[model samples]
Target chain A: EVKLLQSTDVTGGTFTLLLIGMIGTAVLLFLGTGWVSRKWKLPVALAGIVAMLAAAYYWQAREVWLTAGQMPVIYRYIDWLITVPIQVLALYFFIGTVARPPTGLFWRLLVVAIVMILARYMGEVGFMHPTLGFLIGIVGWLYILGEVYFGKLGEINTKSASETVQTGFFWLRLVVTIGWAIYPLCYFIGSFAGGVDEGTLSIVYNLADFINQILFGLIILYAAAKESATAR
Target chain B: EVKLLQSTDVTGGTFTLLLIGMIGTAVLLFLGTGWVSRKWKLPVALAGIVAMLAAAYYWQAREVWLTAGQMPVIYRYIDWLITVPIQVLALYFFIGTVARPPTGLFWRLLVVAIVMILARYMGEVGFMHPTLGFLIGIVGWLYILGEVYFGKLGEINTKSASETVQTGFFWLRLVVTIGWAIYPLCYFIGSFAGGVDEGTLSIVYNLADFINQILFGLIILYAAAKESATAR
Candidate 1:
């Protein structure tokens, strides 16, 4: 059974922002679902995944909204459990659908992203020694970096015919490396170093998720839209 | 006098990564310095500021490496004090020197950036209520956004001759809007909500700083380089 230490004093702002985040994602999900080509529809599905996760967050969080003082931490992780894996898979979908990389590179990219997200979930939930899990998480991140910078993925990006793929790959890699660095840092300091309170930690995670889910989905959508236009 | 509550344990990987991040910026600084023209020198100086900041972090973080349980909180803020103004100034400089936007935009952008950073700093150090500070900071950020998206700055971008300016501005603005939402979240949670520990807070700030400093510098350098060739 899932456990929640409920606080009846929930902040209106978090709930409000969670709802706003959900609605915004929902709009994008609709764009992907309604407008995108069937040949290039996965980005929309990826956006849909985020919308659902945001909805999941809103539903779980809002249910205890009146009774809970803080949003249930477990629901946040549960959202990640399903959403994070999908998010990584979405990136893999992007690499294949847009860049159309070779098979080995494609598999490696997907594997690294999965490992990174899974390890992070385990670390956060205390299923693993948090620091060790974080280290493993870093390894997964580093592996992705290697593929983007020094591996065949880099080669594919260099030679790709799609302008969107060429341009998107650079910024996508930047977003992944620099933006995602915060998670491990959070683990190291907040979870391991006794540095932050639950409120601060949740805020950081919320902010990161908003950017990660929304901005990343938009980029995928932009690329898919570009590809669809060209295909037509 | 500077005070540090010291700990005997140090994380070698963080220290090492900080060092590497610094070195990477240093190389960019040198490239901007030695290769760029006098007309386009501010971006190089911005890179120099980041390299110096990385050095300052290394120096401060390494000093208590053997005795400190965590990285010094004050030094992190201090680094921001020195670097933030320069980063804003760099943006102004890039707009002037590269995009060659009209005169008022330069000053407006600088003023907006400075006001935003100051509000955020004051909020972080507790001179004002965190939420209030964050909102004020957001105002400044929104001003920049308005200028870039709907104001004369957008007009300037459309007319700018350099491909680098066009390409760089698109991504740079995307970065600013997306990347900066974290600060307010941190303030709201850490300061307002009474959640988050100093260590976790520091880690978030550090990761944001590294990404903010390095990636922002690279975009400026790319623009400056493009502009310099045109001027030559």
Candidate 2:
């Protein structure tokens, strides 16, 4: 008899967690936007849209995983391709709340973010040599880190007068540097390490995504809420 | 070899339609709430929440059906038990904009809507005799129709001065009367028809829900927008 999942199933359990993470975060971010002033609402609502987009993908991914008993790699990448870029762009908008960053910074970060996700996707799906794809993806990520931490974006953050914006920038940069490390680490292990199964990789990916997407958005929301409070 | 679904699959196609219906409706309703006056925002948001709630359940149902190749009966019922009652309660609040529905009317409609869903659920799952369960379910639905159409709620609608509300009331009542008939019709056929396949029944039900939930909300949103426009 075919069954969607048993209560004790491990992978199914992780899928449930991601589903909850996406939906819960979306609701909180949407509701949270209402409390903040108009200037900060866009960033907070952008965070919410990220969660909602991920939630839709997770629905399809859950179906794919449960029925096929296989990793839903394509769905995950499709989600990342759209959401990750928006997330990168969200940093641009988040900074805009305090002072306008150069418009060039916006397009630069967008391009880099898309390249990062695309390179990794190509590697995972065999469009390029895995090592080449991995290396390109790493370069794209490091470029973002440099741009946000030590490049023009970083310079703007240091000059911003709002302590709330400064604090938000510090944490956002840290997330890009540290929280994002899990993706490459998992990719290296899955591609280069011998004998790692798909199920383990899938679960780890789900957990990483839960941290990556939801936590990233929550940080933006916290900053927005704080900025709004201080202004009043 | 198990597969989630092929591109040309009919049941899978219907599932896709329902997924799109729920998510699309939720987004539209949420966005539409912004253009409306503050007084009408609550009702619009409620409609969005109904769609959002159904979207979550549809994710599970899609997984269950794709994996198990079964009807996903329980998921659908669980969804109905929550959302159908909320839709009924939404009517109470919708009418509240032009006139306060009797508090008793709210409680009565809620109770009856729940009974209608639960009775059908019990019969479908074999927890009660099919014929008796169907009869009770029909009675519950008919009672709701009478109350909304010819009883105290109907009385309030007729007395309301707003043309927008009157038109909305007409469409909303028509949905309850006509749009909702598919559920019992499907139930009766599934229980009594000797040769109906589960796949056909599932597709039909999905289409009905697309009508019942999304169309029902759209009618309300249209009226609310109209009311807002007229007031301005």
TM-score of each: 0.48, 0.53
TM-score of 2: 0.53
Please give, for residues A1-232, the per-residue lDDT of candidate 1 as tens digits: 1122122222333453454445445544553554556756875677667766776687566545534545545576567666765765666666666456676765676666667767767866779876776787789878877877777667777777788877776766777677677666766776568867656666666666666776677677767766765776
State the lDDT of candidate 2 residue by residue for B200-224, as single tens digits: 8888888888778888888888898
Docking outcome class, model 1: incorrect
Q: What is the DockQ of each candidate?
A: 0.02, 0.07
- Summarize candidate 2's per-residue lDDT along A70-155 as a digit string, tens digits: 76455566567667877887888887776778888888888989888777766665667778888988999998888888877788
lDDT of 1 at A84: 61
Give the interface RMSD of each candidate: 19.0, 6.2
In candidate 2, stretches whose alpha carbon ends up further than 4 angstroms from where it belongs are A1-232, B1-3, B125-127
TM-score of chain A of each: 0.79, 0.93
Clashes of 2: 0
Deviation (Å) of A108 in candidate 1? 4.6
